[model samples]
Target chain A: MQERVNPDKANLIAGATGDWEVVIGIEIHAQVTSKAKLFSGASTEFGGEPNSHVSLVDAAMPGMLPVINEECVAQAVRTGLGLKAKINLHSVFDRKNYFYPDLPQGYQISQYKHPIVGEGDVILDFKDGSTVTVGIERLHLEQDAGKSLHDQHPEHSFVDLNRSGVALMEIVSKPDLRSSEQAKAFISKLRTILRYLGTCDGNMEQGSMRADINVSVRKPRDDLGTRCEIKNMNSIRFIGQAIDYEARRQIDVIEDGGTIRQETRLFDTRTGETRAMRTKEEAHDYRYFPDPDLLPLEFTQDYVDALDADLPELPDAKKKRFVEDYELSAYDAGVLIASRAASDYFETVATGRDPKLASNWVTGDLFGALNKLGKEIGESPVSAESLGELVDLISDKTISGRIAKDVFDIMLETGEAPAKIVEKRGLKQVTDTGAIEKIVDEIIAANPDQVEQVKTKPKTLGWFVGQVMKATQGKANPQAVNDILREKLEVGEE
Target chain B: MKVDEATVRHIARLARIKVTDEEAKNLETELSAILTWVEQLGEVDTRNVAPLTSVVQMSMKKREDQVSDGDCADDIIANAPEVADHFFVVPKVVE
Candidate 1:
C-alpha cells in the first residue's frame, strides 16, 4: 500500500520547491563540418561575401536540381558514429514546406519519417562531479536557411544566401534534463565531444552550433503538460537563462489560474525574456513529404564502421584518461579537456614534466593571461615548450616562484621563451646561501630594534624577510632567506 | 485530427495569416483531412522505430585553422535593400 511516486517527479521536487517538473529537451543544430553545402557545391564557409558562395541550386534558380555532396554524407555518417547512434542504411529527405523570405526554395529538405541516426545518449558531468546521461532522440541532416537582415531597412528586408544550403545536423535530445544547470552542462559536454570528434566546431558566436530549447512545467505525478520551444538561442548562457526564465514563467502562469500555451517563442537577449513568436506548428502544417528531387540516402555498415574507427578520442574517454593517467583533479581535468586546444596545450607541457603543475599553469596562470589578452589557448603567445621550460626552471631552483612571474610576463609580451626572458632580464634566483645571508644580515643590522622584537615576537621576523627580499629585487631565494632568518632570530630558543 | 473553425482561426492568427472567415472554415476541413492522414503514421508500430531527424548522416565540416575571411564592404552592401556607399541604409527613426 505504499504511495506510488513518480521517479521523475521526485527528482524534480528535490531540485526545486514545487510540485512542478521541468521537462527539458534540446534540439541542437550543428553546422556540418564540410567544405561544401549538402545539396550544392557552394562553399560552406562562414562570414563569406554575402551570396558569393551560393551555387545555382542554392539560389533556387530555375531547373536547378541539387546534387548531393558526397563529403557531406560522409560527415553525417561520421557524426552518427560519434554519437553512438544507429545509422540507418536507407534514409529519405523530405520537403519541410514553409513560407519565409529567407527560404528561397519555399521548402527545406529535411528528414521526416526515416532519419539517418537513431536514439543515443550523452553523458554530462556537472560541477558537483555527478554524472547524468541525457538521451539523444535523434540526429538528422537539413539545409540551413539564408539569413534575413531585418535591420537593413525599415520598409524592406534583405536576404543573405551565404548560409543557405549549408548542411546542418539537428541533434534532438529526450526530455531527460530537469534543470538549467544540467542543460548547460549537457550542452558544454556535447560541444566538447563534437569538437573532439572533428564533427562540429561548436562555435556559438559564429552560428555554427545553436540550440532550440523545449521547456514544459508539469505538476508532480501528473501527465506531461504543454511545452514551449525557445528558438535560436545562440549562446549557452542564454540557453540556461531562457530555460530558467521560461520554466518559472510557465509555473507562475499555471499557479495564477492561467494555462500554458504551446508555442514557438523567441528569446530576446536585449530584454532577457521570451516572447511568443508563433503557435507550435504540427507535422501536417509543414506538409512534409518525400523530397522528389533527391534520392534515398543509403550507406553501408563498412562506411559507418570506418568513420567510427577514425573518431578521435571523445571527451568522456579523454577526460577519464586525464584523471587516471595524468592524475589531474576532476575540476582541473574538466577545465583542461573542455576545449581541444586547452587539452593539447596541457599535454605538450605535461609530456614529461609534472602533470599537476602543468595543469595549474594551463588552467590558472596561462588561462588568466589568455583571457586578459582576449586570446584562445590556440592563440596563446607563450609556446607550450616555453611554458614547460619555465616550470622546469622553478623545479630546478634556477628561478624562484616570485621571479618566474616577471619572466612569464616578459615571455607573454615578447613571445620569447621563459628561459631566454629570464636570461635577458637577469631574473635568475640568487639561491647562493652566502649572497642571501649578506642581504639578510644587512637588513637585520639596519633594523636592530625590529630584530630585537623578533626574539620575543617570532612573527615580527617576517617583516625583516620582506625587506630583505625587496632589497634583493625579489631575486633572493625566498626559502633561503626564510631559513637563514629563522636560524638567526631563533638563536637563543635553539 | 478534426480541426474546428475556431481552431483554424486561431492557427491562422498564430501563423500570421490574414484569413477571412470563409477561408478559415475551408482551411479547417482541409487541415482536418491532412491531420487524419498524418494520424495514420501514429498507428504504425513506431515505438521501436526511431524518429528520423535528418536525411543524411554527417558531422560538421571543418576548414583549415586560418582566418580566411576579410571584410568586403562592397560585396556585403551589394544586396542591401537600401545602401549608402559601403554601408547599409536604414530609415532614420530618431532625430
Candidate 2:
C-alpha cells in the first residue's frame, strides 16, 4: 500500500487564515431490483396507485408478521460481491425506531451492528488518466419508507404506502474523497457497477438511487473536523454544487471564530445553498435491539461461491482485458467500459477487425454525432455492424479515409450500410494505377511552375497530390496518387 | 435499576404518553422495584450460553420473489380516520 497524503492541499479552499482541505463521504441508498418488497409479498413496482401495493405485513396489521424475500437477500449479496466487499455469513436485523407520517410502523427494520457486507473498495477513474480507490465501510439492507404528498390537500397530507417496506441497500463509504469531482466519479462508477450486476437500475431521476453527502474542512495534517450531512441528493450535479457550497460555508464559520455544529442539512436546488434542517442538540437514542421476529441470516460458503461464479464480467475486469487483448490506451478503455451498452457495442465492432481504427471511429465519430443529436449509444441510428463495415471499407482501400467520412455521414442520414452507401453514391476510391496516373499526368501538365519547383524542392510534390485528389473528387487513393505523382514528375531520384 | 422522576418523564415522552404528576410519582417506584427484581438474573453465571435470538429454534423463513398479495386499497384504508384517492390522509407534515 502506498502512503498517501490525507489532506491533499491541491483540493484546499482559500480560508481567511490559510487553506483547508475538504473531506467527503457518501452513503448511497440503492433500491434492490426485486419484484416484491423486502419483508412482504407486495409488489415493488414504482408509480402504483396509492396504498394499492401495501400488504398486511407492510401496514403493521395485527397478527401479521414479515417474511423475508429471498431475492432481496440474493441481490444484496450480489451487490457486495460486485463492490469486492466481504460478505458476512452471519448478519442480523434490528429495529430503528423513528416517528414520521410516512412510516406506518413506528420502527424500521435495518441492520445496526452487523451488516450484510463488510469492507470493500471501488476504483474511481478520472479523466486525467488517474485512478483512486475509495474504501467502502459497509452495506446494509433496510426498508424504504412510504411517500407523503403535502401538496395534494390543503390541511392534510396524503400517505402512499407503495414504497413502504421496499428493500434498499445502503452502501456507505469512508471519508476517502477529497474533492467533489472525486465524489461524483465515485458515485458514477458505483452506479455503473450496480447496473452491470443488474442489482439496481441506478436511475436517479425515478429515485432508484439517492446519496447523502458528508462534507468537512480541516487544516493540513490536523485532526478531522466536524462534518455535516446533506441529505437525499438524487442528481450528480446537485451533489457537486452542494459539496462546494457546504465546504465554503464551513470554512467561513471557522474563520469567523465559530465552532462548526454537527447537523443535518438540505440542499436547496433553486438557490444553490445548504441550510440546516436539524441540529444534533437533541440526540437520538434509537435503542436498537435485535429484532425478535426474525432469525439470524446464515448461509454457507458454498452459497457465496455460487453467486461469485455467477457474476458477469465486471467493468474492471473488462477494462483490463480491453487493454491487454485489444492493445487500447487506458483512457479509451475507460470510456468504452464506463457503460455496459457502449462496451458491448464496441466489442461487436472491434471483433476480428482493426481494433484501434474501430476504437477511433466509435469514440470519435459515433460519440460526437451522438452528442450532437442528444442520443444515447443504445439509441444510435448507426448500428455497430454498419460502423464495422465502414472500417472495412477504409482498411481494404475501397474508399479513401476521407471518402469514408462522407459514407459515414450518408450512413447516419440514411441508416444504410456503408457498402451500400459507397456503391449507391459512387464514392469508391480510384486505386487503379492507370486511372490515378492519368489524373497525375493532368495535374503535372497543368501546374508547370509547381512541377519545376517540385524537382528541386521535392516537398512541393504534396501540392500536385492535392490537385490530383481534388480532380478525382477526393475518391483517389492518397497513397497511389503520391506514388504516381512522384514517378510522373521525375522527382523520385531526388 | 432505580428509576428516577426525570427518567420516568423522559420515557413517557418518548412513548408519547400523557402522565399526571401523581401517576409519575407512583410509577417511578413501581418501575424501580420491577427492575430490581429483574436484575437478579445477572446473578446467574451462565457465561458460555449464547444469546437468544428467538423463542422458537428455527431458521429464517423466506418467500419467493413473486407478487402474491396486495391490490385491496379499500381494505387497507378502511380503518383510517380519513381517506382521499385511496391514500390515508393525516395532518400536514412538511418534513
Candidate 3:
C-alpha cells in the first residue's frame, strides 16, 4: 500500500564502537511434496492422528531397511533445477549421528560431504528496482525427525512419528544476504520458485518450510566475525525481526567488551529477543558416514534433460515476459507472477484486452475481492474468461468505464458472465449519436443561463457534460458527451 | 583417530550411554588398538580411485509413492516401551 521506509542500503548496525556490518546466510528446510515418506511408505499428510501415518522404518524397528521413494528424489532434483543449481548425478546419503527419542533412528540419514546440488545464485529483486545475486552454497536431501509434544500431558510428553522420515531438501546459502529485506525477499522468491515447480509446497504454517539464519557482524571491509545461528524461524516477518534483534544484540555484546559466543539461539517471538538454546561447547559432533543401506544416487543427463523440458515457466521468466510481451511495469509483473495461479489467471484476462486495464483489474479489483472474501484466485466465483469479456466490453467502448464497473460488481456477486450482466441490466454505453445529441439539446434548452456562462467560463462545459451523463444513468460514452456538449451548445466557438 | 581420555568420556555421553571410569580406561586401550589397525589404510597410494561408499553397485530401488501402510496406532504403540494415549511417552523434551 505504501513505499517501504528505508531504501536499499548496506546492512550496517551503527554502534558506539563502530558501524557494524551484518552478514546473513540462511539454511532453509523445504519438505518435498510426496505422498510417502523419504525412506518409508508412510504418508506425509500434516495434522494426522499421532503415529497413524508412521511406518515401521520410520519407527526404526528391528531389521527394518529403507526403500527410497522415487517421487521424493525427483522432487529434490526438480527443486535444485528451480534454484538454478547444479545437480550432482552421484551423491551419497550419510548417517548424521545423534540420539533423541523423537529421532527414532539413532542417526539421521543425510548428506554431508557430497550433496545433491552444487553452487548456484538467486537474483533478489528489491523494491527500489535494484537487484543482488545471492549465492546458494549447496542443497542436500535429508530425513525429518519426529515431533515431540510437551503440552498434552503435564506428567509425560508424547512423540509423533508422522513427521519422521519425511524428506526435506536442506538448502544452504552462502553469507551473501546483507539486509533483512533482502533475506525476506530471497525466501519469498525461492518459495515462489518452489511452488512453481510443483516440487515443494512452501507452507511454513504447517512446518513444511522453515529457515535457520546464521548472523554475524563485522566492521565494513573487515573479515566476517564469529556468527551465531537463530533456529527455526517459520515466518518471513519473524525471520526479519530475528535478524534485526540478533544483529543488535551482538553489536551490544561486542561494544560492552564481551565476546559473542558461537552458539545456536532460539528467537522468542513474544519477547522479541533471542536466548541461547545451546552453546558451541555443548554442540554434538555428528560423526557422519555413508548409510550402509542406500546406494549412491546416480542418473544420466537424459533424465535431467527430461525434467528440464517439463519445467514450468518460472517466476523470473514469467515476470520478464509479462514486462516485455504485455508491456507491464516491473512491480505489476512481479505481483502477477508471484503465484502461478494468479499469473495464469492474469494471462487469461489479458489476452485480447488492453494489458494495462487487465493489470489494473487483476491487481486492484480482483485481488481486493479475493482478499475480502477470503478466497483463493482459483476459487474465484467469476472465471477468468468472464473477467476478460468484461475487459473487452470496456476496451471497445460498448459499455462506459463507469457502467463496466457496475457490470463487474454484479458479475462478481452472481458469478454471471459480464456481457450477460451488461445485456440484462441495459448498461451498455449510449454512444448512439442520435440519442446522445437529443439529450444534449434538451439539457442546453433547459439551462440557457448556465450555457451563457459556459462561453466565458469554458470549465462550465464539465457541468453540461455531467448532466448529460447523469441523464443517461452514467452509460453515456464520456468522450461522445464532451463533443456533443461543446458542439450543440456552441460554447467553445466564442 | 585419536582416542584421548577425555574423548572417551565424551563419546559415551554423546551416545547417551553410561560408562564407568574403570571401563573407559580399559575401553580406551582397545579402541586405540582398533584405530591403529585402521590407520594402516593411510599407506595406500592409489589417488585416482573414487571413495567407495556402498559395496553394492546398484542404484537405489524406489517404490511407488503411496500410503499403503499406517493408520494402526495400536500396533505402533504396542512396540513402544511406555505408551500413554496412543503416543510414545518420554521424559519431557524442552525446545
Candidate 4:
C-alpha cells in the first residue's frame, strides 16, 4: 500500500539518480450487468456451455443485422451518471476493422472519438486517510469479443462465443495517477462506486471487469515519455505489482542511457515483471469507420431524465450521509459504505441505535465472521434485526459483552434470533445483585487468604472479580461481578 | 489518411493476417480512398454536435442484486467444432 512519491520526491529522485518519473493511466473494461448482449439477443452469462449463448449475429452469420439492447444502453448511461460524466444524447457505433479467430465478425463494434459519456472524475481514499482525485477521459460502450481457450488443446484452439457481443463499458482515465498504488486505489474505489450504483458487478476475478494499464516514465518537468500498454490485468494486486516493476524497468533503462520504446507488454505474474507483447498500435491502424448497417443512436431528453430519476444514492452521497447523519468517522464511513448490501445492513442496524457501536460490530465482528466463512455480507446468516437485538441486549445489560459474542456465534450457526438463542442456552447475564453476591461469597470463602491480599493490594481486586466471573460462567455482568467481589473482599466500604 | 506499404503491413500483422507485399500495396490504395471519405467528417462542424457513443441514451437497468445459475450449457456448446459431454474438446494441451 505504499504510494508512489509525490511530484516533489519524483523531482528529487530524478535529479539524484538521473532517472525519470512514471506517468500512468488506466482503461477499465467493466461488463454491464445485463441479461443480454449489447447488439444481439444472446445471453450475457459467464462460464456457460462454451458457445450456447451465441446468437446468429454474435456468430457473425451472413445477412444478420445487429439490434441494440436497450438495457445495455441504460446501463451505460447509469455508469456515466455514477461517474458524474456528461451523458451524450446522441452516440454512434463505429466498426473497428480487425481480424482474429476470436472475433468472428472480423471487426469489433465500438465507439470511437465520440463516446457516450465524457470528462469525469473519481476521488479515491487510501487506507492511510489520504485522498486523490483521478480524472476520467471518457466512458464508452462497446461489444466484447469471444474468448479463446488456448489451453484446451496442444494442436488446436477453441473459441467460446458465449461472451461475444456482451456489453462492455470502457472507462478511460487520464494520466493523473503517478504511481501504481494510486492507480489501484482508483480502480478499487471505482469498483465500489459501480457496485453501489448497480451499474456493474465489478467482479474482476470472474472476468466481469479488467484493466489496461498505460505506463511511461519521464524526467521531472520534461515532456511526456514513451509509454507501454499492459494488457488485461484482472486483479488489483497484480496491477500494482505490474506497474511498480514496469516503472522500475523503465527507470533503469533510461538511467543506462537507453531510450524507452513504446510497445505493448504482458505482465508475467510468476516472475513479477513485464515482457514485450507487441508494438502499440495507433487508431489509424484499426481502420475505424462508422458501421453503415447500424444507424446512429439518438434519445430524447425525457428518456435521460427518466434514468436520472431512477438513480440510487451513489457512493459519495451515501458516504457523506454516513459521516454527517450517523456521526461516523471518515474511515468507518468509507468501510461501511464500501458495498451497497453492507451499507444497507448497517443502516438497518443503526436505525434508532448507537451508530458508533453498530458500525463497530458490523465492520468488525460481522466482517471477521464473514471472512472466516468466505461469505459476503449479503450471504451472512445473521440478520440485521437479530444483530441489532444482540447489540441492544448488551446495551441494556441483559448479557455481558463476552456472552453476547457466544450468543452471536450460536445465532450464526442456527439462524436463530439473538434473544431466542440467549434464552435457549441460559446465557443471560447475572445482573441481579443477589445472584452475583452468591457467586462472590463462594469465591471469597474458598480463597480467604487471597481475598485478604486483594484487600491490601487494591489492584489485586481484579483477580477476585475474575474468580467471581469464572464461578458464574462468564454470564455474570462484569460491573456487577466487580462490585460484589469488592464488597465481599471488603476492598470497598459498604 | 494515406496508408503506406509499411502501414499496411503493420496493420495486417496486428490483425494477425498474412498479406503478401503485393497485397499490402493494393490495400494501401484502397484504405487511403476509404480514409479520404471518412476524413470528410472534419468539415461538418461537429463542435456543438455531441459525439454519439451508443444508439440509445437510457440509463442502466438494474436487477435485484442476486446471483442465479446461468444454466445454458447445451445451447452454449452447440457451436463447438468438437465437444465431449458439456465441455468443448480439443487435442491434449499438455504432455
**Fraction of the true interface contacts (Cα pairs closer than 8 Å across chains) found in each model:** 0.00, 0.82, 0.79, 0.13
Docking quality level of the chain pair in candidate 4:
incorrect
Tell me the whole-model lDDT of each prediction, alpha carbons only: 0.80, 0.90, 0.88, 0.82
Taking the tens digit of each residue's C-alpha lDDT, what string does model 4 give over A1-494? 22333564632234347756778999999999988788776678788666777777787877987777777888888888888888898777889987666678889999997788888889888777777778889999898988777775667666767888888999999887887778888898899988977778999999999999999887766767889999999999999999988988888888888988888789999999999974435444677888866777667778888998999998889999999999999999999988999999999999989999899989999999999999998899999998999989988888988988888888889899998888888888887889888777777778878866876688888787777777888888888777666666667643
DockQ of each: 0.08, 0.77, 0.73, 0.17
Lowest-sum lDDT 10-residue window in model 3 chain B: B51-60
* Cα lDDT tens digits for candidate 1, A212-288: 99999877656777999998888999998899889889888887888987788899898889898744344337878
Best by lDDT: 2
**What's the CA error at residue B3 for candidate 1, in Å?**
13
lDDT of 2 at A44: 93
Model 4 CA deviation exceeding 4 Å by range: A1-21, A219-222, A278-284, A452-458, A484-494, B1-95
Per-candidate TM equals 0.82, 0.93, 0.93, 0.84
TM-score for the first chain of model 1? Answer: 0.93
Model 4 residue B5 distance off true place after TM-score fit, in angstroms: 5.6
* lDDT of residue A475 for candidate 1: 89
DockQ category of candidate 2: medium
Deviating ranges (above 4 Å) for candidate 2: A1-5, A279-283, A440-470, A482-494
Q: Rank the candidates by DockQ, best first.
A: 2, 3, 4, 1
